[model samples]
Target: MDLAWVRQHVRQAAAELGFGLVDQTKLVTAASELARNTLVHGGGGQVESTVLQNGLARGLRLTFTDEGPGIPDIERALSDGYTSGGGLGLGLGGARRLVHEFSLDSRPGAGTAVTVICWVAGPPRQRKEMR
Candidate 1:
């Protein structure tokens, strides 16, 4: 997967989708982390963006999937400062903090998938009544 393309498309999509300026930055950073994980650890994956309604609220979901050496220990991997190859090890954990919802799936020999959702937080606006 082309990381640059994913980053660019994510930023553009977030803006066009009505995410606030500050929220968009968070989402973009999350996207970058996930993309980097896929490329560096998962041997590359595909990203999908979807628009959905959640209890009258609008949200965006991003799913990243890859077929590569999966996580051996999810709990440890998520623990702060834990790294297999000796690094800062903040990508997955940090990405989770930057969004509304975060989830991960992986198997030792299978692959890994990460899903993140960012909800547009605002008071629900009442729809105009038809005349």
Candidate 2:
């Protein structure tokens, strides 16, 4: 249920930001993957979505966090094929590749948090002459 919500939320945001079809697809796909990892691996978590703008470029950001047993090996976790659960192990790495920015934080006993952002090139910003 929550994962679906996550995907929907991202989709709406992408649409609202005028993201192209490719951008929308990438953002939603990344969000779904990360949300699933947050639930199955992190033992359930929360996601925060936000919109960003920089010089006419728009972006959607999703942050997922959980209080479950944190990942013990960050290196292995982000590696090509690694899974703490019974899955294909492409969730994290693949999700990261789909987004423009990705960040993950976890401690031995604290928990885990993953943040990703997908950006679309909006109209170019105008440059003023220094004359």
Candidate 3:
């Protein structure tokens, strides 16, 4: 998959979905890290985005899934700067910091799935009537 295009698409989608500048930046950064992990470690994966609705509230959810060699130690993988390869190891941990909610599920030889959910910060409200 085209990582740059994926990141750009995420940025555009976030903007169109009414996420603020800071939120959009965070989403883009998270997408980058997740996409790289999917490519380098997971061998291949998919990223999906959906609009989230909680009653009168609205938000966005992003899921990244992979079917490659699973992580052997999730805790170590999540530790900052803990990479097996000689590469910077900020992908998963940094991603966790960038979202309101983050979850990961994986086991050795069982693949991995990462889900992140972030809301726009408030419920939608209609304008008050003018006197």
Identify the candidate with maximal lDDT.
2
- As a whole number from 0 to 100, the lDDT of residue 128 in candidate 3 is 58
The ten-residue window of minimal lDDT in model 2 covers 120-129
Clashing pairs in 2: none
Q: Once superposed on the true structure, which residue ranges of model 1 sit more than 4 Å away at CA? A: 84-89, 122-131
Q: How does each model score on lDDT?
A: 0.82, 0.83, 0.81
Instruction: Supply the TM-score for candidate 1.
Output: 0.83
Q: TM-score for every candidate vs. truth?
A: 0.83, 0.86, 0.84
Q: Tens-digit lDDT track for model 1 on 1-131?
A: 48778888887777766777788889888898788888889888889999867665677899999998999999877777665562335567878889999999999989999999988755433445798
Candidate 1 has which clashing residue pairs, if any? none
Candidate 3 minimal-lDDT segment of 10 residues: 119-128
RMSD per model, one decimal: 5.6, 7.2, 4.8
lDDT for 129 (candidate 1): 79
lDDT tens digits by residue: candidate 2, 6-122: 888898888878887787888888888888888887889899988888887888888999998998888877887776666545668888898999999999789999999888776
Candidate 1 least-lDDT 10 residues: 82-91
Query: 41-121 in candidate 3: lDDT tens per residue?
Result: 889889888988776556778898999889888898888877667333566887899989999999888889999887774
Better of 2 and 3 by lDDT: 2
